[model samples]
Target: MKRPTPADACEVSTMGKMEKVPTGIPGFDEAIGGGFTPGTVVLVAGNPGSGKTTFAAKFVYEGAKRFGEPGVYISLHEPREEFYMYMKDLGMDFRELEERRVFKYIELLPPLGTESIDVLADKLVKAVVSLNAKRVVIDSITPFIRELGEAKARTLIRNVLKTISKGLGAVTLLIAELPYGAQVIGLGIEEFMVDAVVVLYQRRGKAWTIPVRYLEIRKMRGRPVEQVVYQFVIGPPEGFTVLNPVPLEVRANVDYRELLKTYISELDEVLGGGLYRGSVTLLQGHVGTGKTLLSLIIAAENAMRGKKVLYISFEEPTEQLQQTLETLSYPVDKLRPYLQILFVDPKSITPSAIVSKFVRRDTLPDLVIFDGISSIRRVIGRELYVHTIRDLCKILKAYGITTIFTTDEKPGKDPAVSAIADNIIWLRFRKVKRGLVRTLMVLKNKLRWSDPIEYLLYFSDRKLHLRKLEV
Candidate 1:
């Protein structure tokens, strides 16, 4: 679809408001002013695998399942059995809804002639009337538009789709397919005929490998669309979920003098007592500089003190991390209750998805150890990486959660993160006559002046120890 312009904004303001029907997609209804306006034809257009079918199906399923609204799904292509199975995998069991008599699925074979358009429209109207459906989906209108040409297609939409919407008072989602690399939504005529238009896009990142999905509300007749674009994901349990990156407005009334101790005495001493409450800390270092271990020690120690700690690891799995804790003589069993380890694959998930999940949580953790943020940076690219980190830090600090983000980058490399950080700890390896020795230094401290001296770091008897480094 085309980007909305000034003229489009003016058009939206003049339209009168109507009753809204929620689509049941998470984080989506709120984006579109509580949901789709009733008695309107909405065009859901996208390239193949961009989730047009999923979006339409969800609109129908949710109406039937949650709102007790009867719905009808008319498919010009995909068979009934295949559609049922595919939707079932996404946790939408159309069969069950069909059995309840609240849902109807109709499949029509194509090579649809000019005469067949009337017949198809008649069947759709009959289905809606029979079921007294409140929602309808035509998946899709592309074949009809291509076969019948623009003039005939326009007549079909205006005569049938709009008639069903206005007369029957059902919200209709007309699915349309845009060929790969094509920008226009369904030959251009369908867009004007529809009341609203939503475009789904599967865009590649900077590496051009991972696919990032986005949903853009190109046109909404009655409602004022504040944010046009949103990142979304489609999976099981819930069909489609929008990941809203809008930072929450939270005021954390915290005393800078109050400290959250890590219980590592030497490290605490170096930290000017302990980490300031509601402050963000960045631990930067090269690979194998003991960044992970140090962050884990802080997480585990705080958890042992009955504080909830969320350890988000992008690189390491839970079992591997538990083993490391055991190797360090940490009580893994004892730490399990208070320490919640979440392992996320950077490739499969988008940064917005991760942040959205955190935003939905009922209770925020006392401490969050985000291990290996560099992996996320690599997958999402630099621009998105910076944006996601900035938003995440803002949310965490707003909740007054002391967060520690570990990355495999040297100090001053990522000024964006460093600027957001309240404290920066640089860890590195010093190669001397005795071989490589691990060392730690406080690069920046917002609450107090950082000590200039570097310190030797080592582990003994399952505890980390630190001392002044002497040449």
Candidate 2:
């Protein structure tokens, strides 16, 4: 297992002749110009439980498992067995790599003086040489800097780590412990010494109620840092995954004149026969105005027509939605084959992540219904919410997927959201002689002229009924 030379580690790029070694983290390589340049030292700094260790381990494990590039992990804090067990839980079987003689884990306990730093460096070099490792991670250099002072630690990094990176042609990921809520990354000097710096944050902010994990690339040598911050999650099966922003491009090469009928004859007539194949429709109304029911009806209608429909409810659970369908007399068992229902908790995921998961798919659905999208706006804030929805609609439109978004009507709402939709249907309740009656109005329609007329909407015999109301 001879270590790859600098040339072997290099991957040619269009921007220049620089060589890159992919980190093998999903959605992360693209943010860093394909991957890290060969023989570059990357400093990963983060507070405890911010996934610094997990990120480092994944880098090493991925190199060994996917790239056939051997790796060595030297831990100054974590024990070997515990680290292996934890990594195994995350789907990284380091033991198998070790058995293949391509991976090694060396743990050095603390209580070390200045001399021990040299011994640690020697051990790392020896391990890399023995296994011909191309990836190395030091799970953390914080203790050394704390114990030996910044001056000695700087000397060690410059002489040892950089040498191993350049001389051995191995990419080095040096982990640094950042105190909670601290602005500085790992004693502040580590960033200047490394070729790249990635900071992980676990903190509560305006974006989410719970502590959201974020990955920020403060610096990356020779790479365009177009996006500085990204939401990340560390979970099983995949240790570290970054939620890259979804690319918004209208690439649907479909006929915009084509229409997909909603199966509601009167509503379709009001909507100029049907919705355009690649158009976005907004179903805005106050609560209890049958927004969910109407969206479900559209979804069921499409599903019954043998069209693939995806219904994502941010407010209702899958079981609750199924119950609603049963109560509405919709054939749940029959519609199950074509209609895919998913319940997402707005608090559990970021807006970008949600859009990325559903929109960036290989085979998109024919129609998508987002029920209770107001919850999403509340969770991700206004600006991001608008951007996410705009990008999402663009992606769906490009796939020729008819999308219906249901949001609660509220005062002071940003018009940018409604402006993005190709068509807008405003649902409200009007006081009639017989209590309150539900009304539907087509405020805007891009495909055809929509008369400013309100329709009385109601359900009878499990069927939706609509009638023109004289103004």
Candidate 3:
């Protein structure tokens, strides 16, 4: 399956006769459905350290640097020298633009004892016209209007922003600072006043390990938006990057017989000559039904055949897995060349964390084996657990990787893992007249017709043996 990029999934309607202006920021244009309308007033509001300043600066710098449009950055809180160094650290050379006369900086200090809203608006409008600036950013409108009260502040933004936006035909970004944990964005009137309102904040991702920055398009007037909450990251080179959810389309190409050859002949026969390539096989039974041993057998065989295999065990350590394989008469040293064993503590594992680690690997394996997957269910919730398993299966199968997962389930009780598995091999211990006996049964097989017969399974010569029961 090919994953759809942000460019492919976000297709906004171009029916309206609105002239769109590109933000020059990657993945941001898609959020606003192909950028903002020209000469629009946008409010970038958020708490301190929520990337409000950087967001506004990036827009300004991008417009002046890449889009051939001069911009004005009005600083009310930070010094010009400090702001120059800050933007430079973020890989934006604002000093160069200023030298070329393509960018301007307006500094309006506080103590506006009698300066009315109209006065500030007049200064901003003059700056834009003097520089012929197409883009303008007010570093912050919070302190500037705090003394005016919410009612007066609302009037100031409503009057001032409309004047600048319409007077000079410039796209303006007003930076607003809301107190931490504030319920509303700005004075709650900014959303109504501005043509677009975007809020930036930090949210704990699915894992809750690190706080992820998110940009929310609360309101984009007169434009169709595809996403509301977008995950973003601010770092060097590219100041901001959005982690968009790409839709996956899976297409499988496999030879069922060739895939099944990775297993021993005994297990392969019961699996309709071989397991289907790209099929998720689940081995379910009680604790001591040789589930780990079986999963290792399949992994070890494939590794010895020069196929790459990745084995992940949540229950045991890597040393323990290696010692056990050695004790089982398998050549652990030779097998190490093609196999990689990873032991993840189920207590500390998250679906997003683990999946990200897997996909980001330099190379992918031909087979993925998960032993003791039942522990994952105990750590992650049912919904997330199922989602993790299905996501891994789909991603691996899309690359033609065979998957085998093991779990311990009670009799007649279908576990959630069964839903994602394409084949289910149930092993259990039964008490017969001859004492305790181990048997293998097929609960489901998508490849071919499987007879409902319990086969006798035993260990002989340090290898697994499977055969039909004598009548």
Worst 10 residues of 3 by lDDT: 3-12
Q: Rate the local accuracy (lDDT) of all candidates.
A: 0.84, 0.82, 0.76
Rank list by lDDT: 1, 2, 3
| Model 2 misplaced stretches (Cα beyond 4 Å) | 1-16, 84-102, 236-238, 245-257, 329-337, 359-362, 379-384, 398-400, 410-413
List per-candidate RMSD values in Å: 6.0, 5.7, 6.9
Score candidate 1 by TM-score against the native: 0.86
lDDT of 1 by residue, 32-89 (tens): 8667777889999998899999999988998898888899999988999999999999
TM-score for each of the candidates: 0.86, 0.86, 0.62
- Model 1 CA lDDT for position 125: 86
Candidate 3, 1-471: lDDT as tens digits: 432221332222354677677777767876676777767989888878889888888888888888788999887888888888987988888899999988988787763754746566777877788779989998787776676877787677776677667677788998988787898875566678788888889855454445657788888889666655776667667676555443466555444655545466777877767777667888888988888888888888888889889999999999999998898888988998899898988666446445544443456677889898878877666677787787777666666667888888653464565776788888888878888888888888877788868888888888788887653
Question: Once superposed on the true structure, which residue ranges of model 1 sit more than 4 Å away at CA?
Answer: 1-17, 206-209, 247-259, 331-337, 431-436, 448-450
Q: Which candidate is the best by TM-score?
A: 1
Better-scoring candidate (lDDT), 2 or 3: 2
lDDT of 2 by residue, 1-471 (tens): 111111122243545677778888866876786788778999999888889999999889888888889999999888888998999998899999999999999988873788877788889989999999999998888888888878887887898889878998999998988887788875678889889999898866675656678899989987668756888877666677777665545464334567888888899999888998878989989999989999998898889889999999999999999898888777899998899999988887766566666533645677899999899878777787888888787667656778899999552266898788888898898988778889998988976788969999987777897998644
Q: Which candidate's lDDT is highest?
A: 1
